[model samples]
Target: MSAMLRKWVLWLLGLYFVGGSGAALAALPIEHWTQPDGARVYLVRNDTLPMLDVRIEVDGGSRRDPAALAGLAAATAMMLGRGVGPHGGQPALDENALVEAWADLGAQWAATATLDRLSITLRTLTRPDLLERAVALAARQLAAPAFDAAVWARERDRLIAAWREAQTQPDTLARRRYAQAVYRGHPYGVEATPDTWSAIDPAAMRAFYRRHARACDARITLVGAIGREQAEVIATRLLAGWAAHGCEPLPAVPEVAPLERSQDVRLPFPGAAQAHILVGRPGIARRDPDYLPLLLANHIFGGGGFTSRLMREIREQRGLTYGVFSHFLAGRHAGAFTVALQTKPDQADLAVELVRESLRRFTVEGPTDEEIAAAKASLINGFALRLDSNRKVLDQVAAVAWSDLPLDELDTWTARLAAIDRETLLRAWRRVIDPERLVTVVVGGQP
Candidate 1:
């Protein structure tokens, strides 16, 4: 009954929040500081709701995984929730007990790893009682994940089964090949095989967690009704265990190298109704100087949906594919600038050529004044809506925090987008992408 009531209350809060995000976003004032314990913190105080969202970013993404153990970072993050050790006179909580505890408090916590970082997120009502317990429980999970042998065995098997199932899909197949060619000889190219999955043991996860998920590399972003003082206490408590090891230097990761020449991988999928096509090239990092211009350029090129040039030519006029779009990944290191779409197997060749040609023309001629204006209006208008609720606000805050962007990024987002002129946007786009050098993959249309 208590959990149900909590859900009902939170649901009501969400609905009430739906209408005010634009205003909240335009006026978002982010506060930034470093915790004495070495954890960097970013806070956005939104008092409209009695709820909080907390995200902890660690430098433990898949890119840190050893090639032989391709999924180590993700597995280590998953273990954080399997169980937690006893602390603060609290009982040890297994996965089942952990789930129940969060339910009782009507709060939520989860740990996940992506290509560049491992993130642990917690959300809870800000009522004094609920928030305190939620923090304590999350602190245990962050500091003392048990990495139990039994739990790891179960998780390893489940992961392997899922990966095997994904291998049977056409998109995954094309993506695998695309990643391999695009990220060749890089950590991102390494795929997890069943053998690689089975090789991971509880001990490995523990060691990886200790080395990468340390105080020195931790970043915390909080969005809620909390003030600077309370936010400090919460941040400190979260890193209590992490501070024990002290700050130390971590090894460096190499950058993603651009393709020297064009590479295309075409595979035949017999009897498949459609061809899955992926075209990509190494693109910019989050902190790239041309980030804003390229971002807007991408929108004019393909990311604007129906209004985009790629969509205008390929889908609307040519009747090639029902949908087509493109975007840059923009991670810690260079990620792929990719275009993806599916069409009838017979139309795949024409579709791929059109995409390549469209990119070539856009690179040389660039977006027209009319297209630039429309893209800017769309991007600028939609910026505020991106921060409509606490969750949405938190996501943007976390990105800025993780990318080490200016604290006022949210405040200046639309302004910068609005300031970008046409020549700058074109130069930024043409400077980064060489349509001739794209690594294209086509799967299907077997002879």
Candidate 2:
């Protein structure tokens, strides 16, 4: 064989084995329903694993907190899992019981404050007995949390100390500052001020919960090791007692006038070696038409790890930062596109420049052919891993339902990715990201 022909054979074999033969992707078949109390539910039955993960999301999130009570939503969210039923044995007790009942029936709970909504999530094993107990606990948490003052004080103090500690960390400070600046007047932008947090008494939390935690404003997502029959039974039992709330309207979100702002926060850490920087602005929401396109584009831009543009330019080529990344965090109402990095205080400016320039170039020319193709391949090929576990599958299901996307959306993810070309991507890039409006915040930087 000729020398050139042998090299060609080797390359083809490598591509076939590495990129062709074993790449497989799976899509979840999503189903939807509306409960008698007006709550929406999305279910994906994947019996491959013996686990059930459920997430209950509401339309009122931190953005719903009044200016005088900024942290009210978060405080209310915490109260949901604490005390429920008589003897305060409703939620927290049943929750603990469910965990101990089934060793393999692990369960977890969490909540988040977002521009558009607040979500409470629970994961449990799908064993019939285990699932029933899990549902009962969730129902109690939803329908009858006591909001006891004693528990409230303890949790509040913990949160306050946590917030204080978070303030001391350079990265946390930078992120919070960026959110405040870019989101400005909007509920999406409000910071957890000490005043707002302190004023959040139990009465205020009770009011918030009474107003926001209702059947009319909720969504329940069920995924994994479950079918339609099982999902419906669980949904009905969990959501049945959530009385419709006649609560007050959400706090008005001020219209945030976009601006280019820059500032540096100096902490007392004299010997701290790294400066954490965050840049960007209030961006697209979940309903934006360009959401999917930009999602694909971002994976190539910076969300794709070592293969992303920011990592390639900032870390691989220049070695300015250990890791640099950018992403669009879309919520029900509003989202933010954030570019973040940490570097030696002295090299901070240089790292910021690299991020700025990369974004500038991305908006101007978009991703190259190679980058686009590779990103699509990576996203499509690796998409199945997202469903490898019931918990992960349920997470996506919750996001889809909360975002109000079509029930069959996941099935279309691959085709949608395949549909994009260079031109399509450049158009998407322009719509979602604008380098000129980027807001930069640096914390713990050099003199």
Candidate 3:
């Protein structure tokens, strides 16, 4: 080959590699559509991996269950993967079979409860045959749940036993009481009691399904090894048949107004070695205008790991607790903002004092310029690591759809962090995270 031709070829190859790497670095661009049945669909295609992960979330989660039937929504979600139609298998047996099939095909399926939604998730190799079968089973689970009577009894008994065991754990007991005290009369406060589980008869499950499990309220997200066209078809097949009915509106969770003093709830656990502490109040929702700014601010306050104020004050400086951290919940509706720590029972009072002081300082002065810059850099630099897998990317897409964030939100996140100045951080901190209303719960000691 001529020298000139060789040089041109090398330059072209270099450019191709660099450009291709850039395109891959840009995760998957989000695409959106409304299904013919009116459900929202969000799609992101990442063909780098030979797998697909899908998540379907329906709104009105536990909130749709009647106030009298507190655990109904969760119970109904549990019933789904147990069996659909004539399959009529127990939850564990059905789940075992499903897992076995997924293993046979190198795939997976599962379901879970979140504060505002119930999610059914599937992951599978992108081969046509395995993908087809996996999605078909997912559709059956969604649209044709059997909620058999015998299965309900066993699940109810299991859940009751779990609840009973949880009550014996000081941390669990404190959280239950804390949630009830903080979010009374709202679905947020409900726990899975034997009574609540008993309220979940097959009829109740059917009623909750009819009310809350609608394609109209569903949001479907697909990521990995698929284009927009393929994602749309898969989503349609999986979700289109859900009974098209709206659910009831969520019961109002009243704002946590300031109490004269922070309420201290104490529960004893005999033979306990440590005390578990939780402190904070009703935080802003995910869609709050201050969401990004507050998230950035929180990093400096406690969410930034070793660099945070809580760690410096509580763990590193005084050594009151092994670990201490703070975070806002950012749910579909307002959720709790919390600072949590576990320390020796004898040191509980000292740990609580330190956490309170750290919070007071953060709210008062906000973050310094150096702290702010480091937090932003930490968040931006670490952000790419979050989308490292197809399943993780699907989670981000589902969160965006559920929280009504913009499709281009992830792409713009780093730039947004860079744009946040010190003043912006203080403005968000002052508005959303109030110091006076923070509820304090400590379990295992008198303190």
Q: Give each model's clash number.
A: 0, 2, 0
Give the per-residue lDDT of model 1 (tens digit) for 1-447: 455345434533333232222422334568899887778999888777899999999888999888888899989888898898787677788999988989999999999999999999999999999999999888888878889999999999999999989977788899999998998878867788888888899888988888888877889999998999999999999889886665678788899987999998889887678999999899999999999999999998999999999998998998988999999998988999999999998888899999999988999999899998888778776765676778998999999999999877766666567778898898898789998899999998443
Model 3: weakest 10-residue lDDT segment is 15-24
Best by lDDT: 1
* Model with the higher lDDT, candidate 2 or 3: 3
Alpha-carbon error at 10 in model 3, in Å?
Answer: 20
Reference-based lDDT, residue 331, model 2: 66
TM-score of each: 0.93, 0.85, 0.88
Ranking by lDDT: 1, 3, 2
TM-score result, candidate 2: 0.85
Better by lDDT, candidate 2 or 1: 1
RMSD of each: 5.2, 7.4, 5.9
Give the RMSD in angstroms, all C-alphas superposed, for model 2: 7.4
Among these predictions, the greatest TM-score belongs to 1
Model 1 Cα RMSD, 1 decimal: 5.2
What is the clash tally of candidate 3? 0
Stretches of candidate 2 exceeding 4 Å from the true structure: 1-27, 87-115, 244-256, 260-269
* Tens digits of lDDT, candidate 3, 1-447: 655335334432332222211322233468899987667888876665678888888764775567768788788878877766642242423555655656777777777767788888888888899888787777767767778798889988999999888777888877887787666556666776777778779998887777776777789888877888888788788875564555446446444443345677777788778898898777777888889899998899989899998888888888888888888887766677888889998888888777777777788988889898778767766776666567777888899999888887776666666777888889888887778666788889754
